[model samples]
Target: MSQAKKIMNDPENLVDETLDGLVAISNGLLAREPGSRVVRSTKIEQGKVGLLVGGGSGHEPMYGAFVGPGLANASVSGDIFAAPAPQHVQEAIEAADAGAGVLIVYGNYAGDVMNFDMGAETAEEDSDIESKTVLVRDDVATDDYEGRRGIGGAFYVVKAAGAACAKGMSLEEAAEVTERVQYNTRTIGVAVRAGILPDTGKRTFELGDDEMEIGLGMHGEVGVERSKMMTADEVAKKMVDMVADDLPYESGDRVAVYINNLGATTQMELLIVYRKVAELLAERGLKVERTDIGAHFTSQDMAGFSLTLLKLTDEIAELIDAPCESVPFTQG
Candidate 1:
């Protein structure tokens, strides 16, 4: 059977029911819009820039989960692996905006770009909110010079932009910082197996035993090329080298590293990637000032991982560390 029926009602109810459960456990920090899954910013303050981010639904702890003081003001949740509607994006922006304008920082998918552009238009026409967008196209697997896709590096971009907004930076400034991070960062991923969509209960793609797809996107989009699996060290070198070549960083360039888990990948595997990747950066004379390893971004239950490196500057460093207190985030 391609699709297996679930125990708790229809598969279509999974997303909404899961969100309802989240709001209950959130201690009132998260509020969903009536008739929509989009989470709104109840903590928005006047004269502060609003930040909005969203995409498909499979990536947990993203879109809505990250909404808090040091993160996104609001995040519009869409269906599993499907982009959210433009109205949801607009609602998120309007709810988060407090007259200081709004910034939409999201992945670089074509649907996201088109829908957010429409949301910006709605914000301009329906309200006094000035909106700007920063597309996160950090995936090095796709041609950066061409129509590149977005991937796990979105976590860093979100962190950087949210920190800036919390520091009272204007929408333009926050967007600028996000754009800078997007330009400085690059990501590449490898997948051992495909994910099974909850609604369908079947694999989105096929993969043979011991096979790995290099440069895979978050959604299992066709990557650089399918190849025989290699050793952890070999895979790390290939992924890191691609990023290094894509950016113009040289010796002494400071960077922050993020090793993302694309769902179902064990922490052990991620650590292996991180360890080998760090060695490559060290040999290149790159200074990795900080590192984050987690499933900050995901593609459902895909057993894969992505490596992201953001060349850092003093301004961005401070911006990323600035304090904010939100439901999902806390400051030192």
Candidate 2:
């Protein structure tokens, strides 16, 4: 097979250049930290909790794009699919500090955990900037909830945390809100085709033309099962069943449904999936308080989608509905 196509100046300069482009188009909302890969919001308010989220680069409009009002105050990015260096994370922690302390949020990956933890320690020791962390572990495919890998459900975590911080909640209160959101969220994804790693320019994994991998990780990690491609309705049923069952959602329970495009999946397909999800939820007498559909979290051109369900309480629902603005997620 022929190699995948990527457009860029140089593979080495990809992340930096992308940041430059994002800042340029941000209308002064985003600024890059000198000598580091960290991006910060230009409008962070003093005495409000600062939110910092970082991770590998390939997931566009995620860690970085999420830096704005009612979301992360800053974001640190590593090379594609790689964790940022500890020093980089520390720099973000320091920059995000605004006298109210900073909260570091990211996927529950081992490398991210280690690096961010070190960054928090550095900030506390050197800058006296108190830092806390909220690790998102919402993927239900894993048996270990505490150690479960974070997925698209990170959106809810960031949303709730950002809203709390914007409302002038204390750093501790914001962190608690974030943890609450994480606990109530769950996500599962299926991959119809694998994505190509930017540096290597090769597919992360191979999938048959007529097959799909269910419960696949964003980085193409092995999932629970791989089988023939099912109809959209069938796939939606399976995905919703797995996610809803895990949460043990019952009749009359309210939720926020997020249908995320893995990468190459089109909006049309996502809507089709959402339709099925909505139908299934309705069948179960579950109420969808809000719905977000788009490529909020992606795997770099991978053709698939993920279903994220946030079982909502009154407070959680209010947070998700709070006004926010970012490149990918925006609410009035």
Candidate 3:
């Protein structure tokens, strides 16, 4: 019944303003096209398979923050909770294109799929630049695996693909690695609170004070179940079980345990969740190869966390170890 408090000056300019901030903070590592919304990395190497990731703007540090050496070559953003236009997507493709080919990665949202597909087609039609698409459907909140939403789990998918390209893999090969990682990854999230939509200035979803959402998506859609609040260990146990069982990760499988803060969940809270997650994985004999306990893909101001299990084959592990440098993220 009241205006949602937002710090931005205008909702209409939020996306562009956000891009401006990203470019500024990047300190010469990233740049925005002249009068265009495509944010490209200034550090893209010459003659490698171009890597591009695009989606709506609300999920900060994802699809955009991912641009740099060893990650996405470019990223295009749409308005708040919306997909980028085809033209913008095409511009991103052009920015990413360095001759070999381009590999497009995004969540399985229909708008993203359509826009990215059209963008790829336009690139080929206009400039003869070949490209491939890898759709991420790693969220196991739904029974239909193929129809699942791409959540925080997409981070590793991008990492693997970017590393593959950085390692001199072909477009087709990098695309394959991207898809393989997507399939091997699974995620499940729980939100104890909702995020505010800058466009609407309202909470993305509603929850009673004593309630928590299970299997919540980044978009703030109602989760699969709503239950009274649970302790950190209880929540972690429930979420870890759901994610691990859906992927059917076995006793001997090596995995990277990722704990993603939806938006506002605190460090202390997530680390506690990770503790139980790690203990559970050990009990199941699943080898923990790495643990990523921080924000990768976030929904603005949403107080929750998502757990991602990236089953690491030797290949995925090697790719994960490759060096990458982005303003907000860097790894080796």
Error of 2 at 280 (Å): 0.6
lDDT of 1 at 156: 78
Question: Given candidate 1, what's the lDDT at residue 297?
Answer: 81
Model 3: colliding residue pairs: none
Instruction: In candidate 2, list every pair of residues with a backbone clash.
Output: none
Report per-prediction Cα RMSD to one decimal. 2.0, 1.0, 1.1
Per-model TM-score versus the true fold: 0.94, 0.98, 0.98
Considering summed lDDT, which 10 consecutive residues are worst modelled in model 3? 1-10
Ranking by TM-score: 2, 3, 1
Off by over 4 Å in 3: 1-3
| Candidate 2 global CA lDDT score | 0.89
Name the runs in model 1 displaced over 4 angstroms. 1-9, 325-331
For candidate 2, the 10 contiguous residues with the lowest summed lDDT are: 27-36
